[model samples]
Target: MQACRSAGLARGLGAVTLPWLWGSCRRSLSLVCAGSAPRAGDWRPSAGLGSRARRLSLSAATIVNSAPRPLQPYLRLMRLDKPIGTWLLYLPCTWSISLAAEPGCFPDWYMLSLFGTGAVLMRGAGCTINDMWDRDYDKKVARTANRPIAAGDISTLQSFVFLGGQLTLALGVLLCLNYYSIALGASSLLLVITYPLMKRITYWPQLVLGLTFNWGALLGWSAIKGSCDPSVCLPLYFSGIMWTLIYDTIYAHQDKRDDALIGLKSTALRFSENTKQWLSGFSLAMLGALGLVGVTCEQTLPYYTALAAVGAHLTRQIHTLDIHRPEDCWDKFASNRTLGLILFLGIVLGNLWKEKKTEETKKTIGSRLEN
Candidate 1:
């Protein structure tokens, strides 16, 4: 009777244990499924898994926040972030117009409008070409590593397409000019094509850039006067070269580290420690050259006064510059736009004033002869 009672108890206990064990196994499998599944809000942390997950989420958020914004990529490629290039390219053209108009009349609205459009199209084209050529090298430089071409945001073929579009717009603008202006415009292609390669072979790519950028000075003179006279255009062009050197040196400071790592050469890297002194010399030279041009052209008193404003602007740029800070360098470089505008207005007002004086002189002389 006792043995039979003991066997019944053992059987009952086994029966109860089996279902409990199976239920726990099922619960474990469910937890594993929940953890591995891709559905939203289905995370099942095992033991200490919750903290690790929080860390991962925070890291992902940080990366997304820190990544370069999408719009910046486009702006970087176009160099819209750096407006100095535009000013450098545009100012020389403005000088040419002012100088060309010196002997005749002030720059008309039509000429100014043409120059404005040309500056936009040509600067875009130049940047695109520069990016396409520097794509491989850009990938190696930290500052340029994430640029459109280097980061694979735009392919070589896409760059070529963009180049085509820019050229088309520029060509359309060129067609609006006279035959001589058109010819002078076409002649710039050689310089444009050769400019990107200059950094690879020479430290004086700034000089090459001066030649390329200052072509506008020549074009402006030719567009207005329909002929090339060195006496009128040379001073403006030479002044442009010096201006390019000064501003471009500032620009180069932004890339000094990346350039050094990539084995690229620039005046900034070449004159790293003494950049300020060199810049001072260049600025003084530019001012002197411009002064000579103003005197030679006999620009009106207002024009000279405007040039004095430019001198003040240059003084401010030099005084506040911290070449070690790229942002400061860029700001100083961009301030040149104001300089360009002041000079442009000066040239226009000067010519207009001269014309008014000439008319008054003629009237007085005629009255005297009549008397």
Candidate 2:
């Protein structure tokens, strides 16, 4: 959406400004030279820096500098840095829209707009809740040690405030939908709230995430039709879930060591040695379910061709994945968003072609009848 583009720009600006502000503050602190460590009563306070201005500045600067770049923390909080999570969140809604409009034209502009809004808000809310719960553990993890919460840029109270703001936005988006869709959307909050704790008690937290993220698919269909046909939406929902499993497993590779040390459980740690095999199986399952969804919806050949592209995308992820390297793992995980969009565009095009063919056929039959 153009709005998403604009939002991205705004987010980018915020990203740039946050670091600049922090750096400036740090520079000011660095300029302050003390002849020696201050005596307890000799310290003078200025602004909010307090009596420990030097120590506070140094700590603040180190924390801010070490914090995963402002934009990154925001993105990670929204799971934007790892876009596969967003795609996995978005595709279900896409699948629901396509399926509900099956054998006809594509979903209207309103449906797409609503789903887009919901995706962004819900994704953000989910991340805020997750980071809130994981702040303590995040401080212990190498990659996450500098997160906003862990590094103290934001306090627990501030995190809850941010979370409330995100949820309010999400709720506003949900209210734009029908009663059924709203209810369905509201129902997902429980899963979202508990998702962060899933890893603490279960090795299959990724599975919980799949279920939580894919709820939008059902909401999409329910929004349009007012009720779900399990036969239609279930397979697509499950497919999205499988896709999440595959990608998030790759994601977990980046934190397996840290997770183990923190006593956190994940499929990444569960399938450490045999990650490739498990990823392959999950990838195949995702493709197969997607194929079933296409067939069930009677999608045109173009849609299948697009799905073939998705298959290739997944194949590339699998082949190029280096579970040993965290960067490679993140790259593979983030690539799923492209795959999701490819499939979504394919379905939309297929619907368009089907509509054009139907219209042409109707005109031909009318002319023959008149003749």
Candidate 3:
């Protein structure tokens, strides 16, 4: 009879609370259904979960929450629950590494592995740094209010300590590269450390983010070739920055209304009703620079084909984008990962095609000489 009463109470609560809060109420409900009502002091508010319940749908959030309690806040601080930023940062590295591969070969697996590790660490460090800087402003914004630092789950001193550890690990990764690459990679820290402040001063924070995020375009080439080939790497790097502008601008749109309320600046607010036009301009710039990369690198038909596909993909994103709807903006922003992969596939296949054509020519020459 007690269990039946508890189950009835649980159902009533579920009917009233939001979907996300239902999980929090589960523990209390479970105890009740087990025939023992939680004592008055035993009941905990949903906020006791500290924003974890709000993000239950995210797979990474699920993984983070499964860890030891002490580690969960730090993990959240690093934005591990959001892996898309890491992918965006790493994709540019893969592009340069693939392009720098010896003709007819895939990118160096060891270098790719090394850079992949660096991307995760550095991207996490970047997030930690950003959160630390933005925690105050974040608290004022609904979308960001639940962030670990903003929600008071982690202290500034604790976040600073965490940032140090992340940077130290990232430095260890950088030391594994050649001296020039090491120096080049280390220089990017300035951008990483300062980028979070850009929103407070300029509408072009996405531009600063582009400059920071695409440093990998230059670093990847130097790692593989011992130094960057300006003709090739420069164009690739430029293309990456332009691509960043397009996606990050779309990402910025999600917070623009809040940003306006709080006096923060972003391209989303700068372009306003003209955002699609600005995105189109950035897309054209990105495509043009990519074409230059293909020319400088002497990429084959497959590469250009991939380039064409990227243009179409960008076109679709801009055409269908609804800047007023944050969900649509995020979907468009996430789709750029696919865009990056398409170009990477092109670079790999293009090299193989070039190698095949070279071998065919050699065979023909050998046959003529024998005749």
Which one is best on lDDT?
A: 3
Candidate 2, residue 351: the lDDT equals 72
TM-score of each: 0.75, 0.76, 0.84
**Pick by TM-score: 1 or 3, better one:** 3
Clashing pairs in 1: none
Pick the winner on TM-score between candidates 2 and 3. Answer: 3
Report lDDT (CA) for all predictions: 0.69, 0.71, 0.79
Roughly what TM-score does model 3 have, to 2 decimal places? 0.84
Instruction: Please report the candidate that would top TM-score against the real structure.
Output: 3
Instruction: Show how many residue pairs clash in every candidate, following the order shown.
Output: 0, 1, 0
Clash total of candidate 3: 0
Displacement of residue 147 (Cα, Å) in model 2 is 1.1
Model 1: how far residue 119 lies from native, Å = 1.6
Regions of model 3 farther than 4 Å from truth: 1-58
